[model samples]
Structures are given as structure tokens and as C-alpha cells.
Target: MSKLLNDDVKEMLTNILKDMVDEVYVKVYVDTLTCETCTETHQLMDEISELSDKIHYDLVETHGDKTVGDKYGITMYPTMVVLDKNQEDKGIRFNGIPAGHEINSLLAALVDMSGKPLDLDDATIEAIKAIDTETNIKVFITLSCPHCPGAVTKAHRIAMLNPYVKAEMVEAQTFHEFSAKYNVSSVPKIVINDTHDFVGNQPMEVFLDTIREAA
Candidate 1:
């Protein structure tokens, strides 16, 4: 098969990845029987890891190994749980292939998880920390959508800041059944706790407001 990332894109990603400060450990769960993009996802991780020494990735065959899956509560195929230098699952995850424009989220995660923190005001950071309720954010997206990456990145940023919250980027086209369950017709649909949801690349305040309103 041809390489998932061509040389030009690889060079661009390599240059962009030079911003990483520390190392990132990405645990990729592969499901061969059902996931169509599993091969591409694995290849993407390999290509990405090769680009930066600060980034590291390993594959876990879900059918055989259940250690990481059992700990992280991940059941879906082609899921990637990203960890920082601490190697802890701070709920930084992707439920599908982060391709096309969605690669922005992956790149952001790589940088942030490595060392950089989210650029938010002190008050906003405190507000995110003060939220005690457990929240599950699922940002449904498609690979081609231009606006979806921002939404996914916002969700993940919140998750990274708050231990009580966990976010996942669900690729709508690949996981059609899951998207249909949420009635996801749009590209960037932000669903919280299977209840509160809104569409588009809403601002950080709006995301906080919706999360606060989630039951």
C-alpha cells in the first residue's frame, strides 16, 4: 500500500512538531475485524512518531490484550489514548482516525500533551478546575470538515484541564452507528453527557456554559 502521508505533508508535520517540549506516549488500540481505517491509523501513528523523537506510540491489539483497554474504559476500535510525560490517561483520546482537517486536533494534542498548556486566563483555568461533576464530552466530526478540528481541540483542552471531564473525538463517517445514535447530521456536534449538545466551533465560554449545564 502507498504511504498514508506523502513526503510534503510529512515534512510539514515534522516542522510543526518541532514545537514539542517533552515526550508524548500514544497508546493506540487496533480492532482489525471491524475498523476499516485501523491500518491507516496505525500507519499514521508510525509516520508521526518517526517525525519527532518526542512523540512515541505503541499498538495494542484489542482482541488479545485488555490491560490498557480495561484501565481506560475504551471499547471502540481505532481509539488512541494520549498520555503526557507522566504517562497517565488524562482523558485525552480520539475515537477514530484523525485525518484530513482533524489532524489539527492530533497535532495540538501532541504539543500540549508534551508540555505546553492551554492558553486560557487564570480565572477561566480556575473555573475549569472548580467543576466537580463528571462530564463526558463527545465531539462528533468528519475528516473533511474545516471547522470540526477547533471543536475537537476545545473539548480536549477542557478535558486536559479538568480531571472530572473526559472528551473523545468521534469520527462521524467511520462510526456511523454511534453518530446516528446521537442524531449527528452536522460535522462538529458537541455532545455532553449524552444530554446537552450544540453544534459548530463555539467559543471556549460557550463550551464551559454547556458543560456547566450538563446533568
Candidate 2:
């Protein structure tokens, strides 16, 4: 396959990954039969894994290996799960191709999984830690939306800090069924536990408050 990431991007990724102190595993679940961008997603992950020795990835066919997909609760194509050194699922999921603005979200997830402390505010961290119940956050987005990255990063960082939370970034265009089910009309639409949902780019406190109320 041709390079999905350019030379400049590769160099940038190398610099960004230099801060990684621990191993980060990327598990990519792909379905070639139904997903149009599965090939590109695989190639993109392959290019990224080459940028750093700390990064490794496994490619699993969603239909061919249903057990792994079921374990991760993967229902969409080209889903990527970023795991920690122990191969623990930190609830960081990319439900479609992590290109365009969403690339930043993917990078941030990798860095967090490498045991680096996130730059979130202490108040936000405390708020997330106070939650006692398991929270599942799903942020629906499109690759073209500039504001979606902030939403995704906020959710992923919260999940990184708190064990009770699992956050996923679902590409709206790729998962039309989910988009319809969630009544998504714009980017950065956040759904908590498949019940409470809201739209727009929300602040960290607002996100925590929403989760607290939902839980």
C-alpha cells in the first residue's frame, strides 16, 4: 500500500511520540467487506506504528474474529482501540478513520496511554475521579469538523484519568445508523450511556456535570 501519511506528518509524529515512556498498543478492528476506508485506516495505523518503537498495533478482522470484536464491543468498521502497557482497555476508541482534525484526538489518546499525565485542570480531574458509577461516553463526529477534536480530546482525557469512564469517538459519516439513532445533526454530539445526550463543544466541567447527572 502507498503511504497514507506524508513525510512531514511522519516527522511530526516522530517528534510527538518522543515523549512516550511506556508501550502503547493500538488494536484496529476492520471489516473489509462493508467498510470503504478500512484499507486506508489499516495503512494509516501501519505508518503511525513505524514512527515510534513504543507503538505497536494488531489488525483484527471484525467478522472473521468475532470474539475480539465482541470483547471490545465493536459494531462499526475501522475501529481503533488504544491500550495501555498492560494491554488494558482505557475506554479510548476511534470508531472510524482518524484522519483530518480527529488525528489530534488519536495522538492525544496514544500519549495518555503511554502513562503521560494529561494537561487537564485539577478541578476537572477531581470531578472525574468523584464519579462512582461506570460512565460510557460516545462522541459522534465528522472528520471535517474542526471543533470535534476538542470534544474528543476532552472525553478521552477524562477517561484516561478515571477508571470509571470509557469514552469513544464515533465518526458520524461512517456510522450512519448510529447517527440516525442518536439524532445527530451536528458534530461533537455527546451521548452518555446511550440515554442522556447533548450537542456542541462542551467544557470539561459541563461534561463532568452531565455525566454525574446521567449516572
Candidate 3:
């Protein structure tokens, strides 16, 4: 297959990744037998990693023991889990090929996970860190959706701040059955803990309200 990123795009990403202060790792889980987008997902990781010395990825196959996938709570193929500079899981994931506008979220995640502090107030950061309850945030989106990246970026930022919270970007089209379970009729549907859900690229406070309720 041809390269997913062309020369100009690669140049832009190279500059953006230069802001990374520390190394970041993305573990991509795949099952060749069952995953249709697994190949493209792996290729995308490769292309992104090539743009920066601070970025890397390990291709993990979920065909046998499933230990790695279990460790990361990855039950789906073509899932990319972003780890911090210390190679620790940051509860940030993309459960499909992050092409189109979703690519912005993936890039932002890599930069944010690399020892950079989130641009949030101290009180807001403390609030996120203090949430002791287990929180799961799933942002259902299609690759083409223009507004999806904003929602995904916000969810992932919260996840990066608190280990108790897990955030994932689920490509609705790729995971149609799972999307149906949430009745994801619109793009950028935000689901918290599988019970409280709302649609749109809502503000940070709105997201926190739903998360607080879930907590």
C-alpha cells in the first residue's frame, strides 16, 4: 500500500512533533485474521513514528495469550493505546484507524502524553485528579466528521490527567454493532460509563458534569 501521509503532511507533523519533550509510545493491538483495518492502522503508526525520534509504536498481535491486550483493556482490534514518557498506560486510546479529522486527535494525544502539562487551570486539574471512581469515556465518531476531533481531544486530555479515567475514540463506522448499542446516530456522540450519553462537541465543564454524575 502507498504511504498514508504525503510529503507535505509529513513535514508539518515533523515540526509539530518537535515540541515533544519526552518519548511517547503507542501500542497498537491487532488480529490479522479478524481485523480489517489492522493493516492500515499499523501503517499509520509507522508513518507517524517516522516523523519524530520521540515517537514509537509496538505492533501487538492478539491471536494467542492476549496478555498485552488484557493489560491495556483493549478488547478491539486496531486499537492504539498511547503511553506516557515512562512507558506507562495513560488511559488514552483510539479504537480504529484514525484517519481524516481523527488524525488531529491522534497527533495531539502523542504530544500531550509526552510529559507536557495540559492547558487547564489548577482547580480543574485537581478536580480531574481527585475523581477516584472508575470512569469510562467513549467518544463515538466517524473519520470524516469535522467536529469529532474536538470531542476526542477533550476526552483524551481528561484521561491523561487521571489514571482512574479511561477514554477511547471509537470510530462509529468501523464498530457499527458497538455504535448501535449506544444508538450513535450522530457524529461525536459522547458516552460516559455506558449510561449517561450526549451528542455534540460540548465544553469541558459539560463533559465534567456528565463524568461527575457517572462517578
Candidate 4:
């Protein structure tokens, strides 16, 4: 029982949750509080609960009379499922501590797709004009695939840092038919405006040069 509510771990979680913004939905699951792992899991949940009002977590224990785990097909000790506001699963699953950047990226993607209009500031307008660009690169990838993140990151960085280039990360697993139509057998396949195609990873500098040429 001593491990069930570890003050030190709980405090750390509190600090992490405090940094959350208005657009994050975090769900934590704790199954079976008999083992050390389960105890630590509860501690983390305590931290998450104290983090922010937006952070929602549900605690589950196999020893207790609860069916949360069964509903979600969770037979593991700790599982986290992040869902968008529409209650749609973004397919991001975590078995351990997730990186802040990864979590923030998911939140940003959800916000962008939630019918929220993006207002372009004057700086954005200036940047767009400066690039004088013309090209859209659609990258097919899966959210949970480790390799897919790096590829999407490279493509996204190029788009943000260069106005002339635009990139989109399409969910390949969810859109298997589209992936087959595009002949995407890999995680980070790039299609230049549906005309040119390439596979595998490329460094940031190389990606910039390639996008420039495409534009």
C-alpha cells in the first residue's frame, strides 16, 4: 500500500501536467495494483490528475471489480490512449513515458483538424510571399510507427521553415486503400503533388533541396 500513493512520484506528475495547454486530452489506465509497476502507475495517475483540468485519467485495477480494461482490450499493466475531441482515436498508444514533443504534435494535429480556422498573421503572409513557392508533398505515415515520426518531422520542418514548400502526413494505416492506390509499401513515402514519388528517410537539408526543386 505504501507504493500505491507515492508522494515523490505524484509531485513530479503534478509538475508535468501544469505545463499542459488548452488543447490536450490525456487518458491513463492502471490495471492491477498488486505489483510495483502498477503502484508506480497509480503514482503517475496522481500526477496527471493534478497537472491540469484538461487532463482526464481513469484508473483501473484487475483485482478490483472493474471492467474498464476489458472494454478497451487492455491486458497490460499500463496503457494510454489519446483521443481527439470528436472522440476519434488518433491511434497514438503509449506503454511508457511519452516525449513532450510527440504529445504536443498530436494535440496540434487534432486542433488543426477540429474545424478551427487558422488565421494567418502578417508575418505568415510575408513569409509566404518571400518563399514564392509552388508544390505540395503528401507523405503517408502511421502515427504509432517510430520510423514514421522522423520522416513526418523532417517534412514538417521543411514546410514551416520554407514557405515555398508544403507537406502533409497522411495516415497510411487508416487509409490502406489510398496507400495501395499510391503503392506505398513503406511508412514515409513522399508523393510530390501526386506526380513524383520517393521512399525512405532523407536528412533535413536534403529534404529542403528536394522540395525546392519540386517547387
Question: What does candidate 2's lDDT look like per residue over 1-215, in tens digits?
Answer: 56778899889988988888899999999988778999899988888889989999999976555566988888788899999999998888999999998888888888878988888778777888888899999999999999999899999988887888999999999898879999999888999989898888888878988898899
TM-score of 4: 0.43
Task: Give the Cα lDDT of each candidate.
Answer: 0.89, 0.88, 0.90, 0.52
Q: What TM-score, over all chains together, does every model reach?
A: 0.96, 0.95, 0.96, 0.43
lDDT string for model 3 (156-181, tens) is: 99998888899999999999999999
Deviation (Å) of 139 in candidate 4: 1.6
Clashes of each: 0, 0, 0, 1
Query: Once all C-alphas are superposed, what RMSD does model 3 give against the true structure?
Result: 1.3
Who is ahead in TM-score, 2 or 3? Answer: 3
Model 3: pairs clashing at backbone N, Cα or C within 3 Å: none
What's the lDDT for residue 44 in model 4?
50
RMSD of each: 1.4, 1.4, 1.3, 10.9
Cα lDDT for residue 43, model 3? Answer: 93
Candidate 2: lDDT of 16?
89
Q: Candidate 4 on 108-175: residue-level lDDT in tens?
A: 33333232333345654354445555666666765555665566555544454444555555566544
Q: State, as a TM-score between 0 and 1, how close model 2 is to the true structure.
A: 0.95
Best lDDT goes to which candidate?
A: 3
Q: Locate the minimum summed-lDDT window of 10 residues in model 1.
A: 61-70
